[model samples]
Target: MTSPLSHLATHEVTNQPPAPGDRDLWAGDIVLRQAIARHGGQPGALEPYARALGTAAMQEAARDANRHPPELHLFDRAGRRLDEVRFHPAWHGFMQLSAEAGYAALPWEEAPGGHVTHAAMVYLASQVEPGHCCPLTMSYAATPALRTTPALAPWLEKLQVRAWDPAIAPMTGKRAITLGMAMTEKQGGSDLRANATTATRDGDAYRLRGHKWFCSAPMSDGFLTLAQAPEGLTCFLVPRWLDHGRNPILIQRLKDKLGNRSNASAEIEYDNTLAYRVGDEGAGVRTILSMVHHTRLDTALAPAGLMRAALSEAHHWASHRSAFQKQLIDQPLMRAVLADLALDWEAALKLGLKVARNFDGTADEHRTFARIAVALAKYHNNKRAPLVIYEAMEALGGMGYVEDTPLPMLYREAPLNGIWEGSGNVICLDILRTLAKEPLAGEMLNAELQSVTGTDRRFDAALKAHRTRWPGLPPEAEARWFAESLALLLQGALLIRHSSDAVADAFVATRLARGSGRIAGAISGCDTGAILARIAPVE
Candidate 1:
C-alpha cells in the first residue's frame, strides 16, 4: 500500500506545468546580462542571484500576459487597466524570488552594487509588468483587512508568498493577488473624503454599493476596497468572486491607452456585493498611504531599465553608423552627446540605487523618504530618457523613429513613467507632506548634502539659496522648503553614491597632468575641497 504522503506527492506532481509562454525567460536573462555589464562586468558577483531572479521574472512575465487575459471591458481607450487585475501567481513568484535574493534586506549592504542590482531589478519588473506588484499598497491595505475578517488572514499570508517566496509550500509557483486602490469618481483623485461608495454591515459580511470609475485588476481575487462605513471612510477586502464562487463585480468597459498596451484598464460597478472590512472604520486613507509609497518607488525605478535598454541601443547604433565620411562615434559633437547620455544614464541609475538604500536603511520611519527619492528618480529619467533617445534617433536618422528601431517603442513607453504611480505634482506633494511631519527630515537631508559638497562657500551658497528660497520655518513654507531640500539631498547623495571617487579623481588628475584647461576648469568649478569639508563635519 502507498503511504499517505504518496497521494499528496501525486497531486503536487500532477499540477499543471507552467505553459510555454508562461515565462519571459529571455527578457530576464537579457536584463541580467545588461545589469552585469553596466556594473563593470562583475557577472560572477550577481550571476547566482540573477539566475534566481531571472527565473522568477520569467515566470511572472508569462503569467502577467496570459493569466486571466484582460478582457475587452477591463481597459480604457488608452489601454490602461481600469480595474485592478487579481495578482497573478507569477507576480507572487517574482516577489518570492526577490526576497530570497535578499533584495528586501538590501538596505544593510555597504557596497553600492547590491543596491544597484535591486534597483535595476525593480526597474526591469515595472517595465515588464506594471501595477500588479503594488506590495506597498497591498501591505497598507492588507493589514487592516486581515484584522476585521479573520478568515481572510490566511490569504494575506498567501499574498506575501508572491513577494517573499513563490516557490515554496502552498505558494510554490503561485502568483500574486492584487488589490485596487485608485479613485476616479466625481469626488476627485486626491480627496478620499469625496468617495461615495457605501458599506452596510450585514452580520458576518457587509453589502458594498458603489460605482468605481477605475478599478484596476477587477478580475483579481479580492480588492482592498474603499467604502463609507458607518464610523467613517473605511476599506474592505471585497472578493470579485462571491460566496458560491461566482463573480458579482461588473466590468462596464475597458480603456485603450497609448502606452502600456498590454495592461488592461476597466470601468467597474460594485453592486450591493458581500464584502469584508479592513482595519478600523475611517482608516482607509491611512491604510492606502502604505500602498502608495511602495508603488511610488516602483514607478520611480521603472524607467531606469527602459533607459538602460535605450542607451545600449543608441551606443550600438553610434558605434556602427557612419556620417560625414566618418563613423558617427568619431565625430566630436556626436561623441560629446553620447558621453552626456552616458553620464545621465549613470546618474539616473545611481539615484535609483540611493533611493533603494534609503528604503533599506530606515524600514520603520514614518516618513516616505523612499517615495520622494523614487519620485525624483522618475522625474529626472522621464526628462532625460526622451532626450537621449531622440539624440540616438537623430543619429540613426529616419530608422529610429520607425518601429524597425527599438527607440520608437522606448520613446512611446518613456512618457508613461511620469504619469503613473502618482504624477510629478502628486509625488512632490507627498515629499512635502512627509518632511513637514518629520522636521528632522530637513536637517538629515542637510547632513547628506554636507557629505557631498563639503563646507565650501559655493556649496554653502547653494544650500543657503535653497533655504532662502524655501525655508523650513512657517508651516506651509517649511513644507515646501523641506521638499526642495530633500530633492537636493537625494540628488547629491546619488551623485556621491554612484560616482567612483577613484575614477573621478584619476580623470581629473590625468587632465591636469596633460595641461587640459577644460579639466582644470571643471575641477575648479566643483569646489571639491569645500564639499569635502562640509561632509567631514557630518561624518
Candidate 2:
C-alpha cells in the first residue's frame, strides 16, 4: 500500500466532437444533390456556395445569430414611436448570404429548375439557420399574390432582388426587401372568418384598425394582412412606411417563442394603417391561398432540412464517439437507430422534391396532384420531424442535451414547421376537403401511385388495402389516420421509384408491410449498412 505506482497516472481520454465544416453541404447530401440533378438544376454554383455555408466560420455565425436572438425596439429613446426590431449582426450576415444564394430569386426568375431548385436552396440554408427563412419564404410566396394586384406589382421586382439590405428605411432606399404576413387574431386562431379587424376605403388606399394576434417577422417592409371590409374579409398589403409618414403599425410586443429566436414575431396593432387592397374585396382567403400554398411547401421542406442536419450530427458523433472500446456506430442497436432515422429522412426528401417538381409543371394533372400531395407531405413530414430529431438527440446521449450542441436547437425548432402553415388536424382536414370537392383528386393520387406499379409487392398490397377500405373508412374523425396512410403510401412509391434497393426495401418492409414497430430501431432483415451509407453527409 505504501509503495504506490507514482508514475502510473491517469490521463483524460478525449473523444472530440465532430468538426462541422471542411466539406460541401450540397455535395455531401447525396439524396438532395441527386434530386437537384433529377429536377434539372445545374448545381454548378450551388456546390461551392453550399460549401461556403458549411464552413466552421459560417456555422459559428449561425450559432451566434440564434444565441443572441433578435431584440425588439418598440420606440426610440426620445419616444418618437419608432417600431423596429434589432438583430445581431450575425443574423444580417445570414440574411445577406441566403438572399444572394437565390433562395427567393429563383422562383420569380423562372430559373432552370424554378420551384424545384428554389426548394433545394431553401433546404440547404435552413440546415444552417431557419429563422431568416420566414422572411425569405414570405417574400418568395408573395410574388403570385402580388401579381394579382397591380398596386403591389412594382414591389415584386424588389422582392426578387438578390441583395438583402435590412435597413429600416423606405423601400425606395433599399436595394431589396423581404415580406411578412398577419392573418390570425386573438378571437380567430384557425378561423380567419372570425377576425375582428376592420378596413375602410380611403381614396386609393385603405385604413386598417385591428390587432393581429400573431404577426411573424414584424420588421418586414410589408405585410399581407386579412381584415374585414364592407364587401367581406379582404386581403391588404400594409407597408411599413409611406410618402406621408410611417404607417401606424404599432408593435405591441414580441412572442417569446421556444425556438427560432433569431426572428422576431410580434403582436401588433394597426391604427389607421395605410394599406392597399390585394384582391377582390370579398375573396381574401382565395387571394392569399396561392401564397399560402407556396409557403406550406416551404414549411414542409424546413423539417426535412432540419432532420438532415440532425442526422449528420448524430452520424458524426456516433462515428467518432466510442463506448466499451468500440465506436457507437459499429454497435448493433445504435446502427439500427441511425439507419431507421436515415430511412425516414430519405423518404421525406423524395416526396418533398416530387411535390415541388409538380409545382414546376403547368399541366392540369400536375396542379391537381400538388393540391393533395402538398397537404399530405406537409402533414406527415412536419409531424414526424420532432420524433426523428428527438431520437437523433438521444443517439448522442447527454452530449445532445447541452446547449453547446446543435441538436437541442434542432429539437426546439422541429415542432415549428408543423405548427406554422397549419397544424396536423388542419392539414388533414384540408386533405379531406380537397378529396371531397375535387373528386378527381383520388384518381390523380392513384394514377401517380400507379406509375410505380409492381415495383414492390408490399406497396401494392398496401395501396390495394387502402382502396378497398375507402368506403368503410370514416375520414372525418379519422382524418389523421387517413393522412398518415396517404403519406406512407406516397413515400413508399417515391422510394420505390428513386431510392436504392436497401432504402426502398426498408421503407416497404417497415412502413408498408406492417413490420415496423412504434419506435425507431425496430426494423430487421433490411440492409442497415446500405441505408446508412446512402445518407452519409460526405463520402
Candidate 3:
C-alpha cells in the first residue's frame, strides 16, 4: 500500500517522530506563559517572534546558519582592506527576524515590563539559534553605557531604531545600528584594568593603538572598547564605518571558537583607531560594567532555553522510539530521568524570570536583588545546564552523540555562556563581594528565601541549616558551595511559590531534602507521572 514515491526506498520510515515542525515557542511553553504574566509582562509581544522562530523554515535557517559559519573577508579583489566578516544568508535572515521583532530595542522602547519581555525573548530565541544572540545581547546591553556620554547621543539614538541596519554607511544614514565590544586583551582576559591599549586625545575624539585578544561581534557597526588614556583606563566607542571611509580598526582574524560558530568573534588591531570616550577617563571599568551587568542577565536566561530545547528533543525521541518492545517513555526509569531533568529546566526558568522581573523594579530593594540574584542565577544555571543537557542527550543513546541531532549544538553552547561575562569563580567572588559591600543585597536575599517559609518543613529546615552553616559569609574556598546553596534555595522557594505541587515537591524533596542520589533520576518518592506530564504526557 506504500505510495509509488516510496517504491525505491530501502525501507519505510517508522517509529521516528515527525521532524519537529512549526512550534509556537510561546504557546507551547506554559511555564514561560505563567512567568511572563507573573512577572508583569504581556504575552502578545513575544508571540509573533516566538511563532516566527518556531517555523520549519526558521529551523532550517538556524541549522544552515550554523552548518555554514561566517567567513572572514579581509580584503577586496583590488587589495583594499575590507576587514569584513560575511555570514550565510540564513544568518542574516535570523538577524533580520530578531531585529524586526525588537529583540535588542524592546527594553528601551518604553514597553510595559520591557526587561521581562526581553528576558523571555532571550529565552525563546536561544532555543532556536543562540549564536546570533551575541551581537543583539551586546546591543541591548549597550544602552546604559552609551547614555553616560552626551557627545555620543547620536550613537545612542541610532540604537533605539526598531530595524536591523547592516550597512557600511555612517550612523547618520543608517536606520538602525548594532554595537559590539572589544575589552579584553592578551594580558587582561577578565581584568579590564590590565588593558595596555593606548588612546591619545585627538581633537574632540581620541586615537587608539593596540590589539585586543577578543573582539565580540567583530562585524558590528561600532565597538565599545577600553583603552589606556592619559588619565588611566578608559572606555571608548570605536566606529567601524565613518562619513568618509572605514576607520583604522582592522580585523586580525576571526576566532576559531568551540561553539557559537554562527557569530563572528575576532582579534583586531586599532592602529590609531578614531574613537569617542565614554564616561570619565579611568572609570572605564565602572562604565562598561553596566553593559556587563545586562549581558549577564542574558547569560542566565539563555541556559534555561538550551535546557528546554534539549529536553524537548529527548522527550520526543523517547515518546516515539521503542525499546524492549515498549515505548522508551513508558519505562519508569526513563520517565524519572526526563522528569528530573524537567525540574532543573523549570527551576532555571523560574529563577531567571524572577531575576528578570526584579530588573523592572525601580525601588532600592529591587535593584539590590537584581544585582545579586542575577549572579546567583547565572552561576548555578550555567553549571547545571551542561549536566542537564548531557543527561537529556543520553536519553537518545547513540543518536544523541551525533551532530544529526541538536544535542551536540546544545551541549557545546551550554558551556559558552558560563565562560562569557564572568566564569564560575568570578561570579562566585562577585556574589561574596556584593554580600559584603551591599547590605540591602543580603537583606533582600533573606527576604526572598523567607517568603516561602513554613510552606514545607524540609524547605524551612534547609533554610535554617543554610543560615546556620554560613553564619555570615563562608571563606573564599567555600564560595562555590555558598553560592550554589543560596541559588538552590532561591530556586526551590520560587518553584514552591509559583509551580504546581508536583514540581515543588520534586524540587524540595530531591534538592532540598537530599532525597535523591547525585545523578539525575536517582531518587525515590517522586510522582514521575505528574512531573513528566509537565514535559509531555506519554500516550
Candidate 4:
C-alpha cells in the first residue's frame, strides 16, 4: 500500500514494512486474550483501554513525552519557593488518559477481577509508554497500604475517582490524585533501617527533616516516605501542599537517568516537611510491604509487554523484507529466532497474570502462592527480556538501532523493571527466604510444579533434577540457579495445562530440557509454524 504519487517519484518505496501506527493491542493479541480468559480475568474490561493505548496519536505522544523530558522549576519570578517539575503536555495527556482508563483506580474501584485486569492494563500501557506507568503503579499499590491509616480518609476517597486532576491542590480540591513512594535514601539503597531522615513528633503528626535520594513524580499530591522516629524507622505520608502553603520540600535536582525519561525522578530534601505517620512506629517495612508486593506484579508483567512490542516489530519487518530470493520470515534460521522469542514472551505473560489472579486470594494456598510466585516471575521474566529485545533489534539489521522505530525505547525500558523494587540478587535471596520461612509457600509452589508432572517427561526430569540438586535450600550462591529452575518449571506447568500442545512441547524441549544453546533460538526441532502463529505478520 503506497501513495498514488509513488510512480511520480524517482523510485517507489517498495519492499518496506508498513508502520505499526494503527495496531489494536487487545485485538491483535490472541495469546493475551486466551491467557486472560484462561486465568479467569475479564478481557471485556480491558478492551477499551487497550484499544485507546494502541492508537497512533498515543504512540506519537509516548515518543514526544520521552523526547522532551521534565524540567525542574525551582523558584517563581517573585523569589517565593516553587519547587515543581514541569513535564511536556504529552506526559500530562497520557497521565490523564491512563487515569481515566483505571490504570490506578481499577483495583480499588472493586471489580471482581480488578487485580487481574489491572495487571493486563500494566502490560498494555508499558508497551506504549512505560515512563508514565511508575506513578500509576505506586498509586495502585498504595491503596492497601493506606488502609491502615484512618487519618487520610479524604485522600483515600479521592483514590476512587477514575479521572486525572493534575491541579496542584489539596485532595479536597481535586477530583482525582496520585501517590508516590520515597523510601530510598542516600545511605540505604534497599536497606530501610539505614535511613537517617529523622521525624520528630508533632501534635497530630510529625515533622520530617531529611533528604530523599529519589522522589519520583515529584509533583505527586503526596508521598509515602520513611524516616527515623524515636521508636525506630517509621513510614509517613508527606503531602506536597499544606493548607497554609507548600511544604518545605526542596528539589535538589532531577535524575538524568538511562531510561524512563517521560517520568521524573528527583533528589529532594524534606526541610521540616509536615507529615502524618502511616502505621505503627518501627513497622515501616511491614507497612510498605503491601505496596512492594503489588508493584512487583507490574514489574513482572512489564518486560513481557516490552518483549511483545519489540518482537512484533521484528516479525513485521522480516515478513516483508526480502533477501537472497526469499522473504526473511521464510528463512529457517530467522523463524527459529522469532519462535524462541515468542516462547519466552508467552510464558512470561501467562505466569504474570496467573500471579495477579492470586493477589486477592480467598484461599490460604492462593495467598501464599502469590507471595512467592511474584518474586519468581519478576526475577525470571526480567532476566530474559533484555536479551529478547536485543535479539529482536538485531533482526532488522541497522534500521533497528535508529529512532524511526520504537525498538530503541523498548530496549531502554527492558532492563528498568528488573532494577525496580528488587534487583536480581535481592529477588533471588528473597525467593530463598520465602521458601524457607513459609512452609505453605513451598507446599503451594510444589503443588503448582507437580500438577503437570506426569504429562511431560522432560518437565518431570527437570523437576526431579531440581529437587535432587539441592535436597534442602541451596546455598546463597546457588539462589539464582534455584530461582531460574523453579520459574521455568512453573512456566512449563502452566503451558502444559493451558497452551496448545505445540507451545507446551517447544517450551519443554528448549527451556526445561535445555534443547537450545545460550542464545535466543538454537533449537533444532520445534513446531516453528505453530509457535510463529502466536504473532501475526503485517498484511
Report, for every candidate in turn, its global Cα lDDT versus the true structure.
Answer: 0.53, 0.86, 0.91, 0.90
For candidate 3, write residues 257-321 as lDDT tens digits.
88898999999999988999999999999999999999999999999999998988898899889
Clashing pairs in 3: none
**Candidate 1 residue spans exceeding 4 A from truth:** 1-70, 73-118, 126-151, 162-176, 180-182, 362-368, 371-375, 378-389, 455-460, 473-489, 501-539
Model 1's TM-score against the true structure: 0.69
**Top-lDDT candidate index:** 3
Cα lDDT tens digits, model 2, 225-340, are: 99999999999999987766788899988899999988899999999999999989989999989899999889878889999989998998988888999999899989999999
Ranking by lDDT: 3, 4, 2, 1
Comparing candidate 2 with candidate 3, which one achieves the higher TM-score?
3
- Local accuracy of candidate 4 as per-residue lDDT tens digits, 1-539: 45445454577777777667678888889888987786667677798888888888899999999899999999899998799899899998899988998888887766678888889999999889999999999999988888998988888889767888888887667888899989898888988889999999998999999888989789899999999898998888899888777889899999998889899999999888899999899898899888899999999999989998998889989998999999999999999999999999999999999999998567988889999999999999999999999999999999999988889999988989999998999999999999889999999988988888789899999999999998889999999999999999999999999898999999999999998898887887899999998887324
RMSD to native, candidate 1: 12.7
Q: What TM-score should be assigned to candidate 3?
A: 0.98
By summed lDDT, the worst window of 10 consecutive residues in model 4 runs over: 1-10
Clashes of each: 61, 0, 0, 0
Worst 10 residues of 1 by lDDT: 530-539
Q: Quote each prediction's TM-score.
A: 0.69, 0.96, 0.98, 0.98
